[model samples]
Target: MKFEKNTALDFVLNDLFEHYRQHVVAVDRITSALLEAGVVASQADIVNDHIAFRTLGVAHMGIASFEKIFLAHGYRKMDHYHFAAKKLNAYWFKPPSPNYPRIFVSELIVSELSDAAKGVIHRYTDAIVADPVDSLNLGDGQQIADFLQRPLWELPTSQDYNKLLEESEYAAWVIFNRYYLNHYTISIHELKEGYNTLEEFNAFVEGLGIKLNTAGGKIKTSGDRLLRQSSTVSAWNNALFADGITLQIAGSYVEFAERSVLPEFRNIPKSQLSPQQRRDGFEADNADKIFESTYTAQIKDKG
Candidate 1:
């Protein structure tokens, strides 16, 4: 999340983060705790590992469309990941420079959904016959920022939302919170000693009264055991549906990641080790569980 505010990418990231931080209470909660504990002097000091977004796999949207914004700003598409169980397809974009956090964008496979869920989703998005991002001037950061927050389709009715929630919580989420920054990750390994490992960090976070998503486990580790991640259950907020029904719904959350140095780089001095020397990219198994941070089960499982 720390970047020089001098380019279109910087402005867009900053704008999204500002809106996200304000709504996702845990963002500031963690930042304030870190400040008080002397882990950081300000929010800018915290290194953002990455930011993620969710989109619908409709005709004119999804990663194909959403990715244009970052791709135009010098981000290079890196790897593709598929989640069969969740019916999701995703790609992680490497930042042009290490200073900018990486980007992960995922889209629900609409065609794979049940007819009922597809009908409900299309009722809102079918009208978008043209790709929305195509209409924007990508060079303009403000326009891009506003586009990210803009609603491309009408809000779903409470019944539709609930129905989708039953079939796919991810669907229900995108229907209500389209193109919004789903979650921003904090790079735990970049923190000072005693606070960098997931174990110590999770304890510190829980000690501050924050709840961690326990899907799979409090910590989701990669097969190589080089990447470990944990996240807070999504924040709940009163959401007003198109039908005038208001209900508490899931919003964005915060994620913590620790990328251990690669085995080959073990001999490198800790002080001299660079980000490139650490474990790179993400793991499908790890990300699969991390996606449940917003699920009702995790949100309700206070234990």
Candidate 2:
């Protein structure tokens, strides 16, 4: 269904926001931190601005929230598909934008299977496939290890398990510039010129009050002549948050709220719309504007 920009924005602000309240708090905290740092100007607003305008830390927090919301609805990461794609692409790519991670909720038949039996595998082939996500039935002795494996599977048999996995609908949401930090190489020359060693640079980043999963203790530099790389390896811990899920790929955390349907949409006075409408409206408008600007620049160059 084609929703107006206001309608879509309202859905995100009202529906998605209430549905993921705790997650929003994490996002807000990250945004606040970025503002405190020189990474983002204090006047900038997170909910109504492009994520690219925010710091790497803030962007990761938003992406983490996106993952958790879908996962709470019984979705699982399609690691193979997600990693293989050059960019994050959501299943629902049209109205809401598709530059985020796509997740799938399984519709497997868990009942007749043995204890070690792998449940059915349902893949969300597209964002707007249908009410329920697509399913590939798996019987006993299937040995579909990777797809069915989840922390939830260890739970004792109950209707709750079936309700969690079976009666859920899945949709893919995209996080734009998911690999921003990993993509562009920060010039080591710049770091060396400013600081004597990688530790000094790390200290600077930490001084910004940004927490790093520094379990690896120190950054490691690859000896490659053409491609110099340095990284602080750590797991993204989500244990502190209500949701136990963490991003294993990168060291980051996301806070997630318990799943529930959104409350009824409230009517706003036309005057009240001035602020939120202007803020969210600008984001909706400028998204296309930026794309157009980029396209125009490319076209002029070609001409």
Q: Write the residue-wise lDDT of candidate 1 on 143-212 in tens digits.
A: 9999999999998899999999999999999999998899999999999998999999999999989999
lDDT of 1: 0.94
Best by TM-score: 1
Candidate 2 wrong stretches, greater than 4 Å: 1-5, 13-21, 24-26, 38-117, 120-130, 133-205, 208-303
lDDT of 2 by residue, 104-206 (tens): 2111122323332222111111222321212312221122121222121122222322332232111100121111211101222221234323455446545
TM-score of each: 0.99, 0.27
Which pairs of residues collide in candidate 1? none
What's the lDDT for residue 160 in model 1? 98
